[model samples]
Target: MTNLSAFLAQNAIKPDSQERVVSKRFVDPETKEPMKWQIVAVDSDRDEALRKQNTKRLPVPGKKNVFQPTTDYDAYLATLAVECTVFPNLHDVDLQNSYKVMGAEALLKKMLLPGEYAEYLKVVQNANGFDVGMDEAVEEAKN
Candidate 1:
């Protein structure tokens, strides 16, 4: 095949799907290492669903408890994440066990600390170019 033909054959992707990776890394407290995540891009339909899921109004006024129907903010973003990779000097097995233990919240706590869920939000958005709160009021405004 011609070089152009060969390159296209190797690099081309199916139009139906796109791939993206997190622009930043998360630090693992258990292993004291940094890890990165990757994921596939969701279409506009999926984005709309996420927007709806994250925009739930508070059931009662003056109550912001997370347990209630208050906005999830970025929970939808987390659902898009597919995998995470740790930085050098950390064994894969160790990280794997921690994945079994610390889970996403603990890992994010270690990675982002004072930023907490905000950092997790950043990781998910940066990975797939999602902005969680950008449309928090779109539905109500439309109605």
Candidate 2:
């Protein structure tokens, strides 16, 4: 996994364009809720504008902040790429490799298992090509 991690780590794109916009988000741990933060900077100076943009964009909702109990995370900020609105964070190859190694199906199952739909496990089993009577399990759950 070290190679995979290294590949991911290196593939991280460094921000290039100067003009950036930033927004803040604060999370409520008890409910895992997020509040959109106010936008901070728009300066005439390129350096100042870039600094503000970097500061504004970094924090992502589920990926970065997990809400630790000991300290106040209000100071913590993340600046995400504005282009991500149009595209995904990682390239196709990286995403595919990540899925292969991380087993995104299992992650989805773990997240969805608590809901009223108990077919998460069945779906995951089927996706993984397990012959564990998944069709019957899914059909039964649907009923």
Candidate 3:
């Protein structure tokens, strides 16, 4: 029989938080240097919740009392980015007021430019382990 002890929660490796220089726009006032954003890998439960929140059910036009589920990908990513970010406090009221935005998602959208926003979303996805592919993992394992 295989040793299952290593798979136990206590024995398993925990996800570590990471700091990344996502953008050069935000800088320290005194240091005149870019600030790194803190991010962490969120558990699957949180991701599932976000997914469900973004998904909407629409009534099927031809069917009786039936609905088709659809997910808003852009909304999901925006929410995910806000959830994973740990530094500069996206939820801070002062930050939101400064950006003239009401919510965390809105603040993030307003802070970064169009291209920067797209790149930041990619960075957020990567932090959550979405950047790796099966082929890349296989290659790394082989090496």
Candidate 4:
């Protein structure tokens, strides 16, 4: 987590940017090794372009709206929680709960295994804030 903050700072990720989302740790299944988590913002333009390219289908309609990349913090966190693969009981519980709360918003997608997601959650829980990078973004935005 601390390392992730540093990496983000080194990369100049802006705190105020709507694209900013907290990254979580994930574990690789093949080797059972832990890996850094990543936060991803929704790429609406790219998605739209994809949809246009594949107009044969309507993109399951409203699915994108249910989980827009930036604002879906809970969904995003939930996504990570399901990816760590370290915890199964917790993952299943969270998935079931999220399914109910989201009313299929999260159900439509597959979640990471419990064991994998658990390990990842451990890394995320210790996640750090990117103070230096955030400061730079603030200054840059002001300029």
Candidate 5:
């Protein structure tokens, strides 16, 4: 096979995105009830606006006051961009006013709860065709 053909064959896109259901029932922090969520890996849109969003970044407020991603959660709620908003802090907020002009793709990096963050990372890595096995590797190293 020619080198050109080999290169073309190497980058085939998967027909379906990766998705995983929560294995164990989780307690909804607020409702105190069992909850199950299906986490799905999605594609990032390469639109001009989105590109601009990524290019633009929020400044770190430093030691005194750190920024909160949940503050911008409302915006993602409208676009349902939770999958894309992986880097922000996801603190529980009853305020409907949160999630606004958070500076470009603020949703790109929300601070999620530890478990939620791990799940989000899994989706992102899978979308990028990365095996999310660093944790497993670390565990194996300990043995």
Candidate 6:
């Protein structure tokens, strides 16, 4: 038995934001140190919206006017990374222009190399609490 008041909006605990050195190439001019990127946990509502935006409707075979919704996982991750990134301002037009990219997702893709991008995606997932699995959690609990 738990008090329902604890579930109230005001009583909710907000997710913590984290900063990680995503790239060593982007260094501070004065300190000559790697720059850190700020990432935050995306709420479920926003996550759902991003997912929907990346999903496409494909025509189903043998059925006229029938469509099946398919989610583009790579596109969704790129969008999620863009949304969760608080620093470097991926949405900035100037940044996009400098990278010769149009959208935030494109800007992110252009900013990092392939390997860096993949690692950054892992960091983003960790920040969003997606790095944990139920099996691991169960194992840890039993220990």
RMSD (Å) per prediction: 9.7, 22.5, 6.1, 14.5, 11.6, 6.0
Per-model TM values vs. the true structure = 0.36, 0.16, 0.87, 0.21, 0.33, 0.84
**Per-residue alpha-carbon lDDT of candidate 5 for residues 1-143, written as tens digits (9 for 90 to 100):** 46565457458554454444332344668987655434334444532233333332344567445543222222332233344333232332422125442533343333235476456555545554546385663443233
Candidate 5: worst-modelled 10 consecutive residues by lDDT? 69-78
lDDT of 4 by residue, 74-134 (tens): 3444443333223333335566685564432243233445665443334443332323443
Segments of candidate 3 deviating more than 4 angstroms? 132-143
lDDT by residue (tens digit), candidate 2, 1-143: 25565458568654332211111233456766553212222223642343344333335468766432221111111111111212222234465475553433332222222442243233323322345573563443333
Number of the predicted model whose lDDT against the real structure is largest: 6
Residue 51 lDDT in candidate 3: 82
- The predicted structure with the larger lDDT, 4 or 5, is 5
List lDDT for all candidates, in order: 0.46, 0.32, 0.85, 0.39, 0.41, 0.86
Q: After superposition, how far is residue 123 of candidate 6 from its true place, in Å?
A: 1.5
- lDDT for residue 56 in candidate 4, whole number 0-100: 34
Q: How do these models rank on lDDT, best leading?
A: 6, 3, 1, 5, 4, 2
Q: In candidate 4, what residue range of length 10 has the lowest lDDT sum? A: 15-24
- Judged by whole-model lDDT over C-alpha atoms, candidate 1 comes out at 0.46
lDDT of 6 by residue, 42-113 (tens): 989998898889878899899999988877777878888999999989999999999898999999999999
Give the top-scoring candidate (TM-score): 3
Q: Is candidate 4 or candidate 6 better by lDDT?
A: 6
- List residue ranges in candidate 1 displaced over 4 A: 1-36, 51-57, 60-70, 80-102, 111-120, 130-143
Query: What is the total number of backbone clashes in candidate 1?
Result: 0
By summed lDDT, the worst window of 10 consecutive residues in model 1 runs over: 82-91
